[model samples]
Target: MNNAIKDKVIEILSSIKSGVDFANEDQIVTGGILDSIDITEFITALEEEFDIEIGMEYMENENFDSVDAICEMVEELQEA
Candidate 1:
């Protein structure tokens, strides 16, 4: 995974919900670190930060579960 993407993702997530170790937390969605509203805000932030639109197809818990997963999704979207 890209370190830059990972760092940006962590920053974005932290902005939405503070005091959570996004880098080490693998169950962000399942563990309830972010709610529905936070997820919406996060997606918006990610779109602006990465210049990529996160469509409904990409809105899944597995996609946002961890920093690595988020980086992977961002990389995939960037490639597209």
Candidate 2:
């Protein structure tokens, strides 16, 4: 399930920009893989894909920093 989420996340990231190795690049926001526009698009994609709402409380750098972190957040949300 985690791998599936990661794969989906990678797919979404690729939609924003191609040829970027998201598997290795953990610092997605810091590394500038996702800019403001991309993050906006990412948020929409995430909400739709995960069927969860990312409230303001979950909007943090730690949550969006890496694919693993995002997957963990999605899992946590699902569990809740």
Candidate 3:
């Protein structure tokens, strides 16, 4: 996995929600760390930070589950 992308995603997630260790690639959604509002803000933050548009097809639980998945998705989108 790309460390740079993962780190940035962790940073974004941490900034959105405090007191949660985002370094373990934790399942934010399943763990109840990210609520509906947090998820919405998170989507905006990620789009702004990465400078990429997340299409509706890319909006899925698995894609937003962990930092690693998010990074992978970013990389894939970048490559595309």
Candidate 4:
């Protein structure tokens, strides 16, 4: 995974109640590593840092669910 994306995940995970030791993709998202507020804040930070706009379709948890998922999304947007 990209260092930037990984770092961002760690940043968001730091704020959550559960420990942010994501061993797998499902654990991070379904395990409640991030909530709605965290999502909004993360999107804002992502937009600012990566210079990409997260459209409505990309806002869903399925896309931004985990650190890996969000990293993939960022890579896709950056590639585009």
Predicted structure with the largest TM-score when compared to the true one = 1
Regarding lDDT, does 2 or 4 come out ahead? 2
Q: Provide the lowest-lDDT 10-residue window in model 4.
A: 15-24
- The estimated TM-scores of all candidates read 0.96, 0.91, 0.90, 0.73
lDDT of 1 by residue, 24-49 (tens): 99999989999889999999999999
- lDDT string, candidate 3, 12-31, tens digits: 89898878887785578877
**Candidate 1 structure lDDT:** 0.92
Order the candidate numbers by lDDT, best to worst.
1, 2, 3, 4
User: Which has the greatest lDDT?
Assistant: 1
Question: Residue by residue across 1-80, what tens digits does model 4's lDDT show?
Answer: 78867786667556543565553556544556677877777778788878999999886767766677778888999999
- Clashing residue pairs, candidate 3? none
Candidate 3 wrong stretches, greater than 4 Å: none
- Measured by TM-score, how close is model 1 to the native structure? 0.96
Query: Worst lDDT window (10 residues) for model 1?
Result: 1-10
The better candidate by lDDT, 1 or 2, is 1
lDDT-better candidate, 2 vs 3: 2
The C-alpha lDDT values of all candidates are 0.92, 0.86, 0.85, 0.72
Tens digit of per-residue lDDT, candidate 2, span 1-80: 57888899889988888998887888988877788788889999999999988889987877887888888998988888
